[model samples]
Structure formats: C-alpha cells, structure tokens
Target: MWVSSSAFEALLDSGACACPVRLGQRLDPSGEYVRRYVPELARVPGDYIYEPWKAPIEVQERANCIIGRDYPAPVVNHLAAAQRNRNAMKELREMLQKAPPHCCPSSDDEIRQFMWLSEEGQATATVGSN
Candidate 1:
C-alpha cells in the first residue's frame, strides 16, 4: 500500500521515479546497496557506481562493466522521458480541470474505481455518472 501510494504520488508530482542514486546516497552514502545488489557495478568507483552510464570508458573498463556490453545501455533516456510524461500529465490535469464536475470523481470510492479502470485501460465514461 505504502509503495503503491508513493509511486502514485511520484507520478503525479514528477512523472518519474526518484533518482535511485540520489536516494541511495541519502540512505547509504557509501553505495553499499548498489555494490551488493548490482555486481556489475561492484568495482566501479563510488562516485560513478550509482550512475554507471556516466562513468567514462576508461572507468568502465577498469570496473569491468562496459555500459553497452556488460550491462545494457538504458533504452530510454530518463530525463527526456520524464519531461515528456510531465508535459502529458500537465495537459491531462488541465483538461480534467476544464471538464464539468459531473465528469470527475467526487468521492474516495469513485476516485479509486476511476483510477483502477484507468490502470486497466478500461473506458471510464461512467466514473462519476449519476
């Protein structure tokens, strides 16, 4: 419940996951979490271990974790994707705000059902209908 709520909040706020390295740095400054869970990054220097893709080719070689070969490069650029999602969410929020009250959920139960239907890719035309 907590995790789901947090993720939903993050999506509403930034349309992106909190930066893993930043969170890790706050929780475990030594990068212990990455070293333990991501063996490919075990030998990377603490400065670059959290964001291995930022590490230079020489550093990657030394760490024995080539960004594209050892560990796949990111398929989507996170920053760009986040910005795109944020814009789309902003537009959605604007559209929703412009909609009539009857088109919006007015109760917690209705809100939950609406969100569930949205997640399931189902039509939500009846969400707040009388």
Candidate 2:
C-alpha cells in the first residue's frame, strides 16, 4: 500500500488517478457502463452521460435527468484536488532530493519510519541516522 517517491510521482504524472469522469470517458467511450449502472443516465446521450453537469438545460430536459434534482452535481472539484496532490508530491520530491545520502532509508523498518514521518507532514525529517 506504499510506494517510493519516484513511483508515486510516476503514477501522478501518468494520470492514472484521473477523476471518474475522465476514466469513464476513456474506458467506456460509449457510456455503456454508466447507462447500465445508473438508471438516471440511461437515457442520456453519450456526449452528456459522463459529465451530466455540463449538459445544457435542453439536454437535461431531453435526458430527463436534472443535474441537481435527479442526478446530483459532483461534490468535489477533481481538477483542484489533483492539482493540490501534485503540488504536495512536488514538495515531497524536493525534500527528498535535498536530504543527505545517509538519510535515505534502505530497509523496511527505515522505510516505514520515513513513511510515518511523511504522513505526519514531516517530509523534511531525516530518514536514517548518520
């Protein structure tokens, strides 16, 4: 459940954790998955199904799924959250790069300690004793 800083950075850079709307558009281009699972969107056209909030009022009326009343708008702004995560990861990478070579954890216990420090918002903390 944990990954090295480089691996985590690669994941973020790869957009593997993109928001559900992007994932759905990529994996289910035809919106079949959404239509099958979400009855409210079953009648929505492929263009509007994935991101119903962007659908115009006419489209919503035609689809019979109101953004707020029937389907509900997205609660979180995925783009903002992703940007914040990227910023945090960038800071962590900078901290790791500035750390002394001896501060790099080489063992499982050391790695765990390093991770604990990171989770505690102490990415600047020394990882291993010199």
Candidate 3:
C-alpha cells in the first residue's frame, strides 16, 4: 500500500471500498498540469524528495527545465517531505534490526535427512553429495 495504507484503512472503515476518489496511481490534485511541465520524477542520489527549487539553475537548465518559471512548485514543501522520509526510514530500520534470527533445532545432517523422502534415500543422496 506504500503511503496509502492509512487511506485504504480509512476507506475500509467507512465501508467505501468503491470510493470514486480512491484512485490508485491517482493524478496529482493539480492534475495534468504537472505532467505537461517538468516533474522531478524521483529524488537525486542523496536527497529524498524531488525538490526542483533547491536545484542549481545550471542543473535545471541541463535537465531542460527552468526552475519556478518552468516547473510547478512541489506539491508539498520540500523541508516537510525530507523530514517525513527521514523519520519513516529511521523507524523502518529500527524495526528490521529488531527482527529475530531464525534457527532450527535440527543439525545440518538432520536437516539433510529430514529433506529426503526416507533415510535410505537420504543416505544415498548424501553419499553422492559429499
């Protein structure tokens, strides 16, 4: 669900699964106006949000779009977007690092035997494998 998880849950809560405005890949509120002009489709290497305003004029010119005069203002303020991404990534990293490592009670030999159809099959396969 990406960032739309909350909105999806809201729709389910309201029993409005078929809500018309609940469009997937929905157009920006500003509509095709954004697409017709330059869209910073993605963030550059280090930056999280595509904030055209902060980009150098030379960089914008190289990209073949003028800043302010050419591209529309970012839908949300860049500072806010940057903060949101930073916090989200931080939380996610913490969650992942806290996840438990998995281990089985069986040893490597036991695992190999368990995977085989029978002990005879395991012995035969294990002989060839080794």
Candidate 4:
C-alpha cells in the first residue's frame, strides 16, 4: 500500500526523532488561513486541538511553497503539541475514571453500526454526485 507514515514510523522506531511533531492548523501569518480553515475542525469534538508546529520536519520540508518566512514557524514544538493532547485526554480519562461506571452514554456496537451505515450512505451519495 502507498502510505507516507511508515517512513516516519521507522525513524521513530529507530529513535532518530530529533523533534517529533503534532499536526494541527494554526493562524497563518496573515491570519487568513486560520480564519478560513479553523472552523472546519470545529466539528471534531473535544478541547484537544492540534498544533501545526508539532508536525515533523519532513512535513516541514514538504511544505515547499506552503510555508516560508512569510509563514510563521510552528509556535510550539510537536512534542509540546502532543503533550497538550495527552493532557486533555488525561484530564478526560481522570474524570471518567473518578466517576461511577454506570454511564451507558452510548453503546460502542450501536455507534459502529450507525457509522458503517452512514459511511455507506455517504459513499453512495458521493458516487451519485458525479
């Protein structure tokens, strides 16, 4: 399969990670990029936000025409970005762990079924869109 991540995975496995990164969109230098695209991620529920700088250097190198002096270097380290996500999830886990386990909020099986059907419907719609 054609996939880009395995290379990085190997690097990581070998411990050559001079700086690991998290992935996220941020307010581009002009702020227009963020203003236009940040809203798209709003649908992704959770306070944990991805920080763009966290993306690995290989990602940075690939920016080509995308990021330059015109663009701001990632404001924070990807390691930091990862930590932020971890902290948010950790907080969530702590909250859940401390609570009574009686919450049947939603059945995982049901959610999976609904997701499958929704994906199928979406695929059909996509096919029909042409």
Candidate 5:
C-alpha cells in the first residue's frame, strides 16, 4: 500500500498523471502545479505552461519570462529517465536469475516453473492455471 501510494504521488508530483481538474488527457497541460512551483513560468500561457521551452520570442516577451534566463530548463528528461530505469530493471532481473537459489526463499508446488512470459509480452506467472 505504501509503495502504491508513493508511486501514485510520484506520478501526480511529476505531472505524468492526468489532472483531476480536467478530463481527457491527465497530463498537466495547464501546468498548474508546475507554474506554482516554477514562478518564472507563472505568466506563461496555458498552451506553453507545461512546455515553456516551446514558447516563441514574442510569447516570452509578452510573458516577461525568458527560458534559460529567468528559469532553468527541466533538469531531467522523462523519456531518458524511463529508458535508463528500464535498462536498470532488466539488469536487476538478469542478476536475480543468476543468483544462487539458496539466496531466495523457496516455495512448494513447483515454484521453479511457475513463471513464464505470455505471448502478449506480459511477464506473468501461474500458481495454478486452472
């Protein structure tokens, strides 16, 4: 429960989840929380709030905020972070498989053959297929 809540909170804080303020896309297109924390983008229009980097010169002038000048660019690229995390997880999975069986807790009912990758690309396991 703690992990789930923390993950949910992370998504919310990162603006990766849909905003409850509006329907459709949950992405914080309006940059409500972002603008609140990042005051440099407070005057940015709704269209470019989430992505101030895309704002044009005129828009920047009108808003009186310059990207990289008034506010620093986004510290982390979500796409790159996601790819890195995926690679790390894959490595961990490989390491787990190579570790000695005695290192992990054992279970009865043929636990060794309980897991398999499904055709749809899901990492799945079956306790009892029936």
Candidate 6:
C-alpha cells in the first residue's frame, strides 16, 4: 500500500522494513514517459531515448537530436541518484537512532524537516534532526 514519507519513516522506525519496501528500480528504459513530455527526445530511438547521453553521434544524427544540444544531458546519473537516495536513507535511519528518546514528530512541518522531498514530490527519506 502507498504511504507518505512520514508514515514510511514511522514504519521503518518501528522495524517494519524487515518486509520489503518497494523502492523503485529502473523501468520504461525506452523513455516513454520522458518522451511524452520532452519532445526533443521524441525522435530518439527506443534504445537511446532513455539514455540519450549514451547515444553515439551517428545515432544522434539519425535521430536529429543531439544529446546536450537538443536534449540536455540527464542532470544526475540514474545509478548515482539511486546510490545517493540509499545513502540518504541510511543517514536518516542513523539519525533516527540518535534522536531524543520518546520524541516523535507530530506535525507535518516537523515531519517534513526530517524527510527528503524529490522535485516530483516523492518523499524518499527522513533527514535532519529536530
């Protein structure tokens, strides 16, 4: 079931992560969603649309979309982003471990300060101390 970041953090704090959390992995490597919004990559091949940076110059010519010219290079590498998120989660969990005992965040403002919010509004993890 879907849960907000604060709720998910509460679950983790309660040691419920023993069951798997459905952290996302790469899907739609064809960039279907991306292409729908980013018209620059629409002409890109199905193989290269998801990884425009990896598209060779020849493919760029064929697609008429140059990486970094027609379409901006991905601001963050996917693997790097994933790793960063994982590290942030680890740090948050550690921070939670050291948090003042018997104190729990109650308000949305309080809880948000302890979580990471992606540009897409996905709450990835808790961050910062009180």
TM-score per candidate, chains pooled: 0.62, 0.62, 0.27, 0.28, 0.51, 0.54
Clashes of 2: 0
Q: Tell me model 4's lDDT, rounded to 2 decimals.
A: 0.41
The residue-level lDDT of candidate 2 at 123 comes to 38
Clashing pairs in 6: 114-127
In the predicted model 5, the residue pairs found to clash are: 18-26
Per-model tally of clashing residue pairs = 0, 0, 0, 3, 1, 1
True lDDT of residue 5, candidate 3: 24
lDDT of 4 by residue, 1-130 (tens): 1121122222332222233212222333333444356653232222222443444455544543123342455666656765665566556656866877643326444554655657445554332245
Off by over 4 Å in 6: 1-8, 12-32, 101-130
**TM-score of model number 6:** 0.54
Q: lDDT by residue for model 3 over 1-130, one digit each (tens)? A: 3342222232332211222222312534433433444254232211211345666777667665565666665566545655675566567556856877434435546756567546556555552366
Kindly list the per-residue Cα lDDT of model 6 for residues 1-130, writing each as its tens digit.
2221233445444322221112211555456776788788788887766567888899998888987888787776556655665567677768977877655777555566556554334243334423
User: Least lDDT summed over 10 consecutive residues: which range in candidate 6?
Assistant: 16-25
Better of 2 and 4 by TM-score: 2
- What is the lDDT of every predicted structure here? 0.70, 0.74, 0.46, 0.41, 0.59, 0.61
Q: Give the clashing residue pairs of candidate 2, or none.
A: none
Model 3 weakest 10-residue run by lDDT:
13-22
Best candidate according to lDDT: 2
Q: Write the per-residue lDDT of candidate 1 for residues 1-130, one digit (tens) a residue.
A: 3321222233344434455557788898888878999888899898887678999999999999999999878778767865676677677756866876534466656765757756434334455444
What C-alpha lDDT, on a 0 to 100 scale, does residue 103 get in candidate 6? 59
